[model samples]
Target: MSGNIASLRKEFFQLKKDLLSSILSVGISLILFPFLLGMENSLKGPIFSYIEAFIMYAIFSLPYLILIGVPVHIVSRVATKNMKTYKWVTSFFLHVIPALLIGYFLFKNTLFFLGSTVVISVIFFSVGYLLNSIGASKRQKLIIALLPFILWLLILIPTILTETTNKALMNEPNPEVEVLVNETSFKPRPSFCWNSDGSAGCFEDKEPFLLPIDPIGEEIQTNGDVTVKVLLHNTERSYTIEAYYFDEENSIQKVTGDPHSFTLPQHIQEQAVKVIATMDSSKKGSFFIPIRTGNR
Candidate 1:
């Protein structure tokens, strides 16, 4: 009876580990893959839209299952097998989920980029922990513990080096071009219809006042440029437009308004504009528009 009970417990523990592994893997894969797709921008055509939708589903849903749900289940199993309290395990996840959500809303696009790295690091540590805890012998346990440390070293050294290099490059200054919009008229209408190109035909709503801007296209060119007009259509609101340019080395310089006329500097033909609109003493709506000088 004693031998049978020990065998049963071992079987149960193994089964629990397998189950947790599967859940964590699938949950992580779903969440991480969508964010990866967005960062890569690899998908094209009609399929791109579908993939984007799927990515949204994965990002919002998978963390609950992987970090909170699977971890809870694993902690219970680990507790039973090792007589260790699972309180910390549960608390860690409870804290992580809220932090992750806060980061998601605040960072948006950037959160996914950073989150992917964090999730991969976690998976690496989890694998090491699992191997070490469940090893069959002392030699196996030693290998498992050392392997993770080695793998982490290999991964982290290059990452740190690259970040340092990027930071050094980022500190370098670049040339700038500026464009200024002279018009300061504010429209009384709170809502206006507009085409996607910010043309006179399209309209915008009150609070999130969508400024119409031209979409970028394939086959980048140097002379293909379009003019966009922005109208602040609220009595209480006023807008200021500023355009800037960067040189070949990506150093920024202002090129417009100081001398009048929207000029794309030769060194900074690919420029971007920021339209800042203030209303009732508070800055309200702001948008960015990109311009490239080229004909395609």
Candidate 2:
């Protein structure tokens, strides 16, 4: 009876050890997955803040590790399992295939994801093997496994600096497609555009002039008379607008119209004009609109 009890206790301890090791491997792999993989383009967006990105990354990786990654990790850890025979078979079916498909939707490069998973798997399982096989104190084992993460952090610092330096170097804008519209303090550059009536916005050369900030309404461009109505709606929401027409000598004439119902005077006809405006609404933004005369 004493002998049987000893055997049972020893078996229970071994099982517990294996379970804890497996859990640690899974947890560490999921956490490291995103960081090791360079996924800036896929993760980046105006809508995604840092907290949201971290939460999303965790949510995305959790289920996958639970379903496939954990299983393979445990099976590979089993003493009876020959890693040489199972490496490709398990990795291809359980890790690579699913990861590639998921990456197709989540990332720009599918192969990149596969490579990341491969690296993660190698690091993860390799650490687990070291932890289990090596006879050392628990503290010593933790330090051993943590070496890889420490190395990764060291590499990450220089990569970030390089990316920042590259972005700073690319300070110039596309001169062929975009032009600056600044002139002076009292008088600025004039603009001319049309209503989005079938042709969308009226063009200067070919492509329609686009406002950097979006409009309150669906249509960006409005005509001489139509813009007056737009100003009325925008002003009610605490928007300030300045409308003026420019003569051939670049002298600008301010179009002082009522915020409720503005109308362009007949005298200010047959020339290009613009309105610079800013709004303080739910979607607080600013833009410039140009109205072409004699056309629309």
Candidate 3:
């Protein structure tokens, strides 16, 4: 009877771990995938639309599930299995891999990277503790549950305050180009909408915004010659570059799938490379980049 009870308890523990792992996997996958939430609004057409959207989401979200969710679930299982043999190892893998991937790909900001580390660490720690803290007192369990949230507040509150202060100190939007910073976390890319008012047709409520996301005029490559290879994203590419590129010899070419070449006037110390973009041939605005001519 005692042996049977032990076997039953082991089965229940394994079940709990699997259930929790699955729930966490799905939740984090959704967060990582980002576009998963926009499906409801995107699929309002016919019954066919609903089925299509469901198929699309499953296809799109599968990679995130494998990349982020599976790794996290594996590490969590390791930690829960013994919590002694490889506790720190499990936590390190859980925290570092995802944080590094997110920070490196998304933004190279050090603060953001550190914040990711702290937030994920606290989460894993709290969850691990709570799972094993069944023998602890109520107060201990409560503290374990609330500690991660408190730590996150401490990190984010300062960032919020600093951003607000900086914006207040220097409040100026470029009168020409219309830029939109998406409040939606799902698709975390800034977009330039056709409209400057930040209202209709800007937030991509209609169709996916397909414009080059990177800021313009950041020409890269050499000192002798400047070459800007447009990393053409299916999601974005700067049409503005195609319009206003000219050389000292009056030679020009549109920015295409390859790195388009342009020449600055010889002997001129500096000149502004004028860039203009038009949507539906409406007069949008022109942007200028001042390039200096020198080996220095």
Candidate 4:
């Protein structure tokens, strides 16, 4: 009876260890996923912003990780335990397929969703396997646990430096140019939607919502060509400028560069001119500047 009790306690401790390992693996993979996605877009932000976003995404995805990721991870670990020769093959089926199915429900693009799941599953399995490897030292396990964060910093630091350098070069004074408005803001929107048919869909808006321009006066008076700069943060896409007065289209200008400038019409008194930054046909952002004719 004592022997059976000792064996049961041993089994219980081993189970606890496995569960903790699975949670760590899944949590690391979840945290790394957004950074991986950001890499496709050149990780276009500061390191701190990326960290902040990671924290926010982790917070929001915690429940999903607990509900789906932990169970799947444990199941894969258990299913592949006895299959030493075919462990990887078994792990792939057990880990990747279920994750792919979940991704299919959550994402619309077949290739993108499949690719993301495969990457995540690979990370999850690799981390778990490294942690549970026979004869692995505690130091080795610690390294495995921290590998994701190390990899993230390795990639993130250089990207940020390059971006900073480019911005510095762009900021160098040119005698022929003048920057009227330079502002930045954080505005993020949902990238996915759900259809009535229980399928994932792309979230596209016919007209994107307007983001307020701070420190730039909404009312202004200009006697000649009034140059105004506009920028949309955290996007690599180009935006076109459209000017409207009295609810009629005045002029449309396609802007292909960041920190672009546009000239507002002169001699317009107390009438608001709407300047829109249209990124794509599906989305746009705008701000209003009330034009006054008289001088200060």
TM-score of each: 0.26, 0.39, 0.37, 0.43
Expressed as tens digits, the lDDT of each residue in 175-282 for candidate 2 is: 111112221112223332223232233442312232224332322222334335333221334544455654434465565435522455433333434554433321
Give the per-residue lDDT of model 1 (tens digit) for 140-246. Answer: 55664454245445545655676675564344232122222223222221221222223334332222111124544321223423333454432423334343445
Which candidate, 2 or 4, has the higher lDDT? 4
After superposition, the stretches of candidate 4 with alpha carbons farther than 4 Å from their true spots are 39-45, 135-296
Ranking by TM-score: 4, 2, 3, 1
Candidate 4 lDDT, 1-296, residue by residue in tens: 99999989977876887777777766766667666656323345667666776777677667766787778878887787777586755865787688778878877565454455556665676677675678768896777556545544654566678667656534533222112422322222212222322222433233312223432344443565455665455555555655554322323323333346665555433454455554432244544554554521
Query: Which residue runs does candidate 3 get wrong by more than 4 Å?
Result: 1-5, 8-12, 28-62, 83-98, 101-125, 171-296
Cα RMSD (angstroms) for every candidate in the order listed = 18.0, 14.8, 16.0, 13.2
Model 3 deviation from native, Cα RMSD in Å = 16.0
Which portions of model 2 show Cα errors greater than 4 Å? Answer: 1-12, 33-51, 79-112, 136-147, 150-165, 172-296
The RMSD (Cα, Å) of candidate 1 is 18.0
After best superposition, candidate 4 residue 67: deviation in angstroms? 1.0
After TM-score superposition, the amount by which residue 219's alpha carbon in candidate 4 deviates from its true location, in angstroms, is 39
